[model samples]
Structures are given as C-alpha cells and as structure tokens.
Target chain A: MIVDLRRFLERRRPLWEELDRRLRAVEADPFARIGLDDIRRLHDLYEQVAADLADARELAVRTEVRDHLEALVARAYALVYALEETPARFRPLRWLAAELPQAVRRRARAGVTAAAAFGAGVLLGGAALLADPSARSHLMPFDHLQLHPAERVLAEERQMRAGGDLAGEQAGSFAAMLLVNNVRVSLLAAALGMTFGAGTLALLLYNGVVLGAVCVDFVVAGQTAFLAGWLLPHGSVEIPAILLGGQAGLVLASALLGDGDRRRRVDRLAAAGPDILSLLGGAAVLLVWAAGLEAFLSQYHEPILPYGLKIAIGLMQTAGLAAWLAFGGRWAGRPAP
Target chain B: MIHDGRWLEVETPEGVVFSLPLAGPVARFLAWQIDLAAIAAVATAIAYLTRWAWDLLPDTVAAVNYVAIFVVAAGYHMLLEWRWRGATIGKRALRLRVVDRRGLRLSPVQVVLRNLLRPVDQLPLFNLVGGVAMGLSRHAQRLGDLGANTVVVRVAPVPLPPVEHLTPPRYNSLRDRPHIEARLRRAVPPAAAVLAVRALLRRDEMDAAARVELFREMAAALRQWGALPPELTAGRSDEQIVRNVVDSYFRAPS
Candidate 1:
C-alpha cells in the first residue's frame, strides 16, 4: 500500500516538484504564517485527490486537482515549519526562548534527582558487594593479585611517601600524571562506554567491582589495616571522582534517549550552532575533573593522612559536587568561553 | 551553509530562538533526577505494599507479593504510557512524554521494549555505555528507546492543535457533527477564542460546565479542519477539547 502511495505521488512528481520550488520560495517569506487551518485544508484536499487517484482506473486522471492538492500540502507544511524556525534565525534564546530557562531548570532538577537515586543505588550496591565475599571478588580483580609487582609497586609507593619530597615539583608532576591518567580512565570508562549502554554498565560495574575486590584483596593479603591505609591516600578522592563522572555520563545517556524540550532535546547534537559545543563541554568538564583528581591528588600519601582521612576527602569531594550542583542552579554557571 | 553552526534553529511554543541542540549530559542529568525520584519513591511504596501483602497471606499466596509489586511497577509504567503517554511521575511533574520518532504515542511493542530494557539500562556503571551511544546516535536513542524505536520528549501537558492563518480562506465545514452544533463548533473552535461567546452563550452555569460546553463547540470546529486528536493540546492553555475528551464528547450534543 505504501509503495502504491509512493507511485501515485510519483505520477504527479512533476507537479509536486514544481510546487516544491514554489513552496521553498514562500517557506522563507516573512509573511508565510501557515496555521492549523492551512494544514486542515491541505489534508482535506489530499484525501480528495488521493481518493480520485485510487479511482483512476475508472475515472480520468485529474492532474490539475492532484497538483493543487500537492501544492497545498507542501505549502502548509512549509509555512508551519518556517514560522517555527524563523525567529531562531536572529538571537539564540530569544524572548520566546526565555521559557527554555525554566525548562532547563526543570530538566536539571530531574538530573539531580536521578543522580541521587543512582547514588543511593551505588551505595546499596557497594553494601551488597561488601556483604557477599564472592561478589566482592568479582568487582576488584586486583585485590587477589599476589604478583611480585604488587609488592614492588607497594614498596615503591611506600618509599616515595617517606622521601618527604612531597613539596617537590616531582610530587606535582606525579600528581599531574596521576590526575591525567585517572581522568582518562574515567573518561575511557565513560567515553568508550559508547559501546551501547552495556559497555558503560560494564565500566561502572567493573570499577565498583574492582574497588570492592581490590579492597578485599588488600585486606586479605596481610595489609591488614595497612591495606586500608594504602588506598586512603588517593582512592578516596579518585574512586568517588570517577563515580561522579560516570553519573554525569549516565545522565547524558538517559537525556540523550529523549528529555524533550524541543529546543533542549537531544536533537540539538546534530542541530547547527554553538550549542553543540556547550553540550559536549559539559561532559568534557567531567572528564577533565576526573583526570585532575587522578593525576594530582590520587597519589597523595603522608603518614599524616590515613585511609580514613583520604576516604573523608573522597566523600567530601562527592558531597561538594552535589552541593555545588544543588546551589549552582544552572549547571555550575561556567564562565563563557 | 544555510544552517547555523551547531544546533538547528527551532521554534518553541512561545517562539524562543535557539538552535535545538540535543539534550546533553547536563540536560540529561536534570531529567533523570526528576524521573528517578518518583520512580524510586513509587517502587519503594510498591515493595512495602507487597511486603505487607506477604505477611497477610499464605506462603503460596504471599509469593504473589513479588508478582504484585512487579505488576504495580510495570503496570504504573504501562498505564501512564497508555494514558498520559509518558512516564507517570516524570510526565505529571515535568510534563514530558515518550513518543515515536514522529511524535506519536508508542505502540504496545515499543512500550514493552522500553520497560524490558530498563533493567539493562539501569545496570551498573551508570549506563555509561548506553549514554554515549545515545549521544552519538542520530536519533539520540537510549538503550530502552533504542530497542523500542521510541524517544522520550518533553511534552506540553496540552499540545495545542496546529492553528495556522497563513493560507487563503479555505475552511471546511464539519463532518463529525451536523446542523447548528457544527456551526457553533466552527464559530468557537478553541473555546477561549471568544469570551463573549462563552459568557453570553451560557452565563449561569458553573465554570466547569460552561467551559465544557465551550470546548464542545471548539471540538466540532477542530473536526471540520481535520481529525485533530488530543495531542494538539500539548503546550497550550486552550486544550479543553483534548483534555476533557470524554466529557466534550457528551457535551457536544451533536
């Protein structure tokens, strides 16, 4: 049936083609205010012409009537789309676009809400892994790594801590690399997560799982409380930072799926303008932050700060992000580029 | 070259001017927050209700508790899609919807696909993988809607019917209703177009009743133009014909 409809339309292709040119001309005309009435008339006429086409085997083809119908439909559609798109030609976020703020605000609220719930789920998932010794094993494979390098890296890290060169540029350099690597990993976890949602889930799950497993691995390997002490220096901030980045990434995915304020919808990705940069920018910041934490602070270790202290910093970092977003009330009001 | 750099120019209901960029991380973040809070709250409640049911009934019957909770959760999701045509809590609070690519309601198959994929999309790692794909995809589809061939969009609680005034005067008479009723419907299609008609036509009735009568006429006018469903009521104030469809049907008196 659809093929037949196409063929029928094809028979009048010349007329519609002519009408299309004419319609395109009017489409940009400032006065073309296609309204619901126009669409109605066009739709009504379409049916009449379509019915006549169906009866072409019996009745003579009324090319003129078909042409008129085609023209009307094209005209109506053009007018409606034109009126809807024209104002946007000048200023972005025009007066009518002002509603976008409220809309965006509402969407932001929704994102926060989703983040909280997801966070809660993460906490619960964390608890679930902790409770199940076997499940904990699956999350962090490094936990059970009894490789000689584990001890070597552990010893090197310990030696670095005692060197007291913490104030040196080396420490800063180390921190930077750690931050960069960490951010990249988180981003990798997020960016490479483009493998459909499964990869993202795997990235997130494996991360949590690895944390759980590695934590258990450390504790079981006679690191005792010292094992706890080891991760505290950076894992606290690093882990949660990665988690936060993932939250942003996930939110992007869900919204990408369609949180439709026509102007703010995911369609904007392909839509032409500076807005696409802004859209990608939001995600970029997450990657950058994740990277910074991984590079600069992930390696911080002083007997002065225990696992508990580092963990506190991590928790604080996460909390700070929540507070910032809650108070910021517009995606952190980043300075315009 | 004709298009702007990034976002495509779009015409918002109030006529805002900006390229319509796809909802990104920031926008998505906000949308999820609003959606999950309600879903979690409801899911928790359903769990509690079923938990209570478990205690009241026999083990075999109590086993039904799990099924009961599932039903409520699934049913809530389904019914809202069926009725409001969006996620229940999100739709009511934020006035959004899940629509086909063409902005029509989802088919039953689409609904099932969206809901079924929920468990997967909600998997650990923040649906990170799913999100990137959604962002990159041409349709901006998440895993659920990707499977379902649907996308959730912010819907005006009442999407107004297209009312264009650019074309030549070519108004058609009504086919749904005949005689004086069709005439009245044509005269005041939006119900709010004429205050005098609303006030003077039936002055003494309750506001609701009078509004009902007003919309009935409007609905008839809408019928004349074309087969306009309630979807047109989106994002508009004068959407009574769509909002109170069953009542408007009776009120039309044609």
Candidate 2:
C-alpha cells in the first residue's frame, strides 16, 4: 500500500515541529528554564515521534520521510534519556591535577611493581654492559649505536659539544618522529598490559636494559657528564611518563587479576576505567613536555651555555616534576560533606 | 546501496521502540580514512610552516613539530567528539554519530578512553586488530568503542508524516468521555493502533473473511479493557468502532 507522505506530513508536521522546538529550547538551557511542563511535553512528543517512526516503517513510507523521522526521533530519544548533563569536558586540567594523582596513589602497588621491574632490568643491563663490552652492542639498537661512535663520542666530549647543525626540515621531521615514537611506545606499554601485564613487564624490561646499557656505554666512553646533560633535561619528565604507561599496563593487568569469581573480566576492566584513563592521560601530558625538552634543550648546547647550567636546569626540572606528582592532587579526592 | 548493519532494538519506559541501524565496518573504515587524511593534511601544513619558522630557532623545530603533530593526531578526535556530540569530521561526513550504547550522553572519560586505545586498535600495523574486533563484535564496535561502551549510529533525518484525517461523525463519542479514552489509549499497544490504521487503509486488499476476522480480533481485544462506552458501540460495526477509538486516542492532547 502506498502511503501519501505529503498528506501525512501536512497533518503531523505541526506536532513534530512543536516537539523539535521544545527539545531545542531545553537543550539550549537545561536548568531553570525547563520546567515540569516542558519535560512532560518532551516526553509526550518523543513518544509520538517514536510511534510515528515505527508506523512509517510498516507502511513503506518514502525514504526521505523515514530518514527524517528516524533522525528526529533519535535526537529526541537521546535528549529525553540523556537529560542529566555529565560535565566531563572542559576539565582535562582537573583530570590531571586531581584524578591522575589520585589514580597513581590508589594503584601505588602496581606502580611500585612496575618501577621495581624496570629498575631490575636497568641494573641487570648495566651489570652486563660493565662486565662484557658485547652487551652494549646487543642492548642498543643499530640506529642508536650509529648516533654516537666511541671515537666520535670521545672527540666531541673533548670540546664543548656544539649541537648538531640539523636543517629546518630535518629538525622538524626529527621532532615529529620523536614525538610519534615516544607516544607509540607509551601507548604500546599501556596496551600490552592487556596481555595479563606480562607484555608490559617485558617492554619495561627491554627499555630499562637499553637505557642502562646506553648509560654504561657513555660511562665507559667517558661521556657521563654529556649524557647527564642530555638525558636529565627530558629524562626527568620522560622516564616518569614511560613509567606511567607501565603503570597503566599494570592497572589493566590488575583489573584482569582482581576479577574475583563474581564479576566478569570485562566488568573489572570497566571498574578500573578511571585509573586507565588517568594513567594514559597523565602519560600523554608528560610525553608532550618530554618531547619538547628532548627536541629543544637536549639537542642544543649554545656555545656560551655551560654544562654546569644544563645539569642544574635538568636537576631543577626533575625536582619540580617529582614535587608536582607527589602533591598535585592532595586535597581534591577528599570526601564531600 | 547502503547495507545498514545490524539493528539494535531499544524499548523505552514509555513502551516506545527505537530500532537503531548500526554502522558497518565499511562505513567505519571510510570514516577512519577521512580522519586519517585530515590529520595528515594538517601535519603537512604544520611541517611546512614549522620549516619556515625553524631557521630562527633550528634546535626547537623538533619540539615545536612534535607538539603540532601530537595535537593534530590525538586532540582532533577528542575535542570534536566531545564538543560536537560524538562526531569527528569523518563521522560527520559519513552521517554517523557516536552515542553511548545505553543512550546516555557520551561522557568525557569515555571519549578519552576510546581515543587513547586507538593506537592499540591499530596494533601490529594498520587497523587489522580493530577491523577484526569490529567484525566479531555484536555492534560492530572496535576495541575502543567496546571498552568505552559506545556505538556509532547512522543518523538519517526522518520527515514527519501527515496525520490521517478520517472525518469523525460530528462527535468523537470516545473523545467525549476522557476517562474511557485514556484507559483505552493506555491499554492498547502502539502496534495494535498502527495495525488498526493499516487495516482500515488496506481493507480492500484483504479477503472479506480475513478482514472480518482481523477486526473481530482487534475489537475483542479493545473491549477486554472494559473501557468502551455503550453509546460509542451501540450499533457501530466492530471495524468502525475500533477505528474511531484508535483515532481519538491518537488525537488526544499531550
């Protein structure tokens, strides 16, 4: 049976328009402006639209008519059901200041475990590098090994290390690559936590060993001071950020582990939703800063800038970051009266 | 020919049913490609602009470019999804919108969670893992959407149909008595009312016996509520009486 859309629209348009207007008004000002009357009207209109949409389907109505009604009803449905405005946006800063620290504190056990595992890897790698020179080649990637040669490293260390004279295009690409790689590693660490956290642990171990091996390489090559000047500026923030990724992975693992027999594993993951978000969010924020430091200060040592000043700046940055994490959200998590 | 994916049926407290047409993998992939292209375009623009500015502070180029790329890659989705009601530019272009699976407003936490897991979804290379997960999932939701309890729905505007005008015989006897009208409206399922209208519109198509049986069944059901007044039913045929009652109920005020 053919349904006359034009005829049907002439009769129903007024009701649909009225409903649309009311919904628009309520959406615009959700507070004191919408009274009981508006709510009732919205509800009534939503029901009407829903019924109309169903009828349109059954009657084989015009596609345009069906599409228009479907969208209208969907909008009305969302507004009616989602009346409570969840103020979740415009407060990423708050998430960082309050929620992130609280999350780290709540999951301190996991964070500590991650840190310990990383530290163990570092120590093991450092010991191996010191004992056998071959371990240095094994631990460092080919590109990394290429970055600094033993002879060139020593030669550069003899003079105040002038930063590499990279062209604008080269520097831009380098920066992009660095940021992408760092964030990718961090996200990978966090995601690998889904493998019951063993993957996360392995990544942490690998990273720690590489870092430790590189440190030993610098020490053996007599570039400890240069390494400190380069790493400390960004390492102060970057390492913590990476650790946060580790913490995130551990949190995922914990969620899986913490699922007592009663709840589903997915439910446990859901329960740990905030912690996961906080860890990931915090890590991303830290990575942005680290990227900035590594790209700018670590790469560039102005001819006049002393190594002592760089070391001092790195130290200060590390201390400041530590203090912020320790006390960032001290009072925000308190129970409301 | 758009092959709409699976339908998710949601029944509201008011007994209204909504059948949401879920977006399929093909549409979602296209949307992702659009977003990816947009991000790349923005990154390229920044690369050129950064190159120009880097001559003055060459060492800071990496830092500046790093931030520029990061913001474009990650921040684009978050800001647009949150502010534009769960639609990225790609999603918007495809007429798709992300909505909470349970019909709640998409919260900030959910947005962040979904986007953060994006890299994970692109696991190993490309979005192979995500595509597989989406294909296997009930709602065609990728890992992030599943984790965040959200779904992307295709939203097409459905124009309202004109009301059916069956000129009443002077007075809608049913409408005259508000109590009985309200009771009948409440007791009758929306489907039944729609069926009644369809039956009236297409009576000629049905065989005489089938038509009689259909109205007899409907009239019997309508009377079971014991709200039909004698005046409205005195000598009216079962079909006419049922049609009048359904019409009056539809015309009732909010």
Candidate 3:
C-alpha cells in the first residue's frame, strides 16, 4: 500500500506535539497531577502515538521523524507506567525504630565475623605489646601514645583527670573531629567491602589490633580501671557501630558473589540495599553520640569519679544501648491496614 | 551516527515492544569528564575551607579534616544522584542522566550502590575499568551502573520538530483491507521507508529526471509487497502512488 508521507506528518503532528508538551510538563513536575480529563486525554493520545510509532515502522519515515517519535513514545511510556515513590516522612526515626534492628539481625553472621576479626586483632596486638614495650610507639604515633617515661603513673593520671584545656570552641571542634574520624573509619570498612570484602576484614583487624595494643599499655601501667573509665563511656556504642559497618560491607560482598547473570546479581545487590543503608545510618548516629561523650564526659570525669561509680555508669550506658538496639521500634514494623 | 549504539528492545508485560537507543561510550566518557571536573572544583573549595578551620583548631582536629573531605567526595555524588533524578552537576551540563533500565526513577539505594562502587569503576586510573566495561557491556554500563541496574542516556533535545497539521483524508481505500495493509507494512523495511519519505520531502530540491527515476524505483519495489487496489491507484502517477503508500502506512483509519 502506498502511504503518503506528507499526509501522515500533517495528520499525526498535532497528537505528537500535544503529547510532547504534556510530557515536558510532567517531567518538569514529576509529582504534579493534571485533571482526570487531561490524564485520560493524555493516555489516549499516548496510545495513538504508540500506534503511530509502530506504524511508522512501515513508512519511509525520516531519521529525524523516527527519532522524534521514538523519544516521544519513550517519554509517554515512562509517564504512563512508571511507579511513583511516596515521600517518606520521619525517615531517620523510622530507620532507627524499625529498620536498624531488622538490618542488624539480617546481617548477624557478618557482624559475628567482624567481631571475631576485631577480637583476634586485639589478642594479637596485646600479646605483641606485652612482649615488647617499644612496640607502642610503632603501633600508634609517638604523639598519640604520649607515654612519658620520666613521669610517674600518679602524675599522668592527675593530668588526665584534669583534662586538656578544652575551651568552648576547642570542645566543639573536638566533637566534630571525633565524629568525622569515627564515621570515616566506619564507611571505609563498609565501602571497601566491594573488594570481595577482604578489605573490610583487614580494616577490622587493624582497628582491633591497635585497640588491643592501647589496652596493653593500661595493663602494664596498672591502670585498667582508668582505661575502663575512659573507654566504656563511648566504646560500648562506638565499637558496635564499627562492627555493624563492617557487617554492611560483608553484605555487599555477598551480594556481589551471588550466583547469576549480571542482572540477577544486581537484583540480589538491590535486595541487600536496605540493610546497608540502615547499618550505615545507624552507625553514623551512634558515632555522633560516641563523639559527644568522648569529648565531654570521658576526658573530664575520669579523675573525679571513684572507680566503682565509673564502672557502674559504664555498665548502665552499655545496658541502655543494648536495650535500645534490641527493642527500639516495637510498633513501627506492623503493616498499615 | 558515528557513535550510535543499536536499539535495545524490551517487551512490556502488556506485550508492547519498545526500543531504546543505547548510548555510546564516547558520550558517556564526555559526561564523566564533565562530572570529574565539577567534583574536583567542589573538593577544592571544601579543602580550602576545612584547611582554614584546621589551622585554628587543635592538632587532634587536623586528621578529621581528611574525613570531612572523604564525606564531601562520597556524599556529593550520592545525594545529588538520588535527589536530582540521577543527574549530577556534570551530568546535567552534558545533558546525560542516569535512569533505571526499566525506565523508572532511581531509588535511593540504587543511587548509593552506584556511587559507592565508583571507586571500583575507577580502578587503576582514568576510568580504565569503567570505560572498558562500557565498551563491552550491551547497555554500555560501567561496573557501578551495572551493579545498580542503571544506564546513562542522552536527553533528547527539544523543542521536537515543529508541530505540523494533520490532514486525514476523507477516504483511504487502503485502510479498508487491514490484512493486505498489514502485509504491506511488514514487507517494507523501516530503513527503506525512511529513505523514500526523505526523498519525497526533498523532491522539490531534486532534479526532475532524478526525482522521476527515484519514484519509479520505489514504486516498482513497493509493488512486490502486494497488489494495490485499483480504487487507490487508478489515476495516480508512480510518484503519487509512492506518496499514497507512505501515507497509508503511517496514518491509522478512524
């Protein structure tokens, strides 16, 4: 059948133009709703355009004409069929109450593995430090270790109790500093999980080893009580947060290792997406709280409180964190009817 | 045409087949370059501000500045990609944006995964891994895009060819027999139809002899598809008959 090109263009142009204009409007405001009538008209116009696009397959359509029609059809198809995402209200609160614990539970295997790796590092590091006192300088920077050979333990404890001359600005900066540092380490553990998760394991091990080495110093110095007073204030929360980050990374690696075609693997990876987000977000929040405590309470209160009182407060803080993570959002998980 | 990738055909649940023209690596590379420069600029500005803050603060805070820099780098891509419909500043400048393979808006997790794996895509140096992946992949996806089930596509430039008037004829004899018309449509290849349409539109610019010769060739070739009804072709010239065929194929009957 002989089809007239000019007649086809002349007859179909208005429909294409109308569809194009409406699509642009829709694109501009993805959430905007035109009247029901306009929507129906737009849908009808889209069907007609879709038919024209298919029919254009037979006609000697110009490249420009085909391209124009193709773009129009694609846009219309997306608008008509694309699922809309409902805006999430109170996302952080929702995440904390419902998603966090669920994600933690889902990634428990990875979390256990992470904790084991960290514990091994601590064991190895403490052994290494106990065997050689000189190892402390190498394990941490000299400035960070700050172990004055000439100073007596009592003098150092007094100085620590006094706390650094942290002015208001310095205190604020100290909090920011700790928050950033903790978050960075956590993210690195998680992000590097893309490396088949080996990097995550290595990072966890390194952090644990350093911590173990630091603990050895307190033991050798006969200041285990002081160490607990300083670390327990925040370490209870901070350590778990870091372990969760490592777990998040391991989940990514597992997703990558999933057996399938690339599409199936991507689908698998997407399935793990919520867990990763929840873990990372929860860790970030915990790190912030840890940073605040490390800045204000840990450094300042260590000297004044009796060792017994410090231990009690530390146990309470740990218990509070445990209870919250285990049971924060009881009602949020139920599906709305 | 130089960097054109072939169409990717997908069948919808409703059985409609749609084709997306896959973007080529060259355009993707150019877009990446634009993004790289934009990111670098942002990093530099953040670095300057953070450095000033560090100088005033205690030495303990100095190390944290590096963490801030890392956050800026990672957050820049994730936040913009998720919130801005998958276009970063550079992607916007290059008129390229990331889209889900199924033509849906990108979810937050997809954005995070894609951006997080960017370091993997940049493995070694200068996007070697990403570029190679794009070259080899069917959809020209880098590892990050592949992992995230996303593809970057060129935004169609607008305003699409000016609207033209639709003048449906009072009667189209060919439309009466749907079976014959369908066979005819199936017979004529889309590329050939496009050539014929192009020729007809530019016929005025063609030499009279060439135009006549072109129309005769097209009309002769088109006849092989099926016999045309005499009612539609009784008094038409070969050129007129070709135009009728093209129009009949494009326009649907009421």
Q: Where is model 2 chain A poorest over a 10-residue stretch in terms of lDDT?
A: A160-169
> What TM-score number comes out for model 1?
0.33
Interface RMSD of each: 21.0, 6.4, 4.6
- Which candidate tops DockQ? 3
lDDT of each residue in B1-254, candidate 2, tens digit only: 13446866666666656667888888888998999999999999998987876668765676667767877888899888877777887998897888888655587777877787777678878788888988898888887787677888886544343334343444557767778877877888867766766566566668999989998888887877646766678887778777676666566343
Model-by-model DockQ, in order: 0.01, 0.22, 0.26
Task: Please state the error at residue B207 of candidate 3 in Å.
Answer: 14
- In model 1, the runs with Cα more than 4 Å from the true position are A1-19, A22-137, A142-153, A158-207, A219-284, A299-316, A330-337, B1-100, B103-254
Residue A1 of model 1: what lDDT? 20
Query: Candidate 3, residues B140-159: lDDT per residue as tens digits?
Result: 88877876788887765634
Positional deviation of residue B171's Cα in model 2 after best superposition, in angstroms? 18
User: Which stretch of 10 consecutive residues in model 2 chain B shows the poorest summed lDDT?
Assistant: B158-167
Q: What total of clashing residue pairs does each candidate reach?
A: 70, 13, 16
Best TM-score among the predictions, by candidate number: 3
lDDT for A152 (candidate 1): 41
lDDT of each: 0.44, 0.74, 0.72
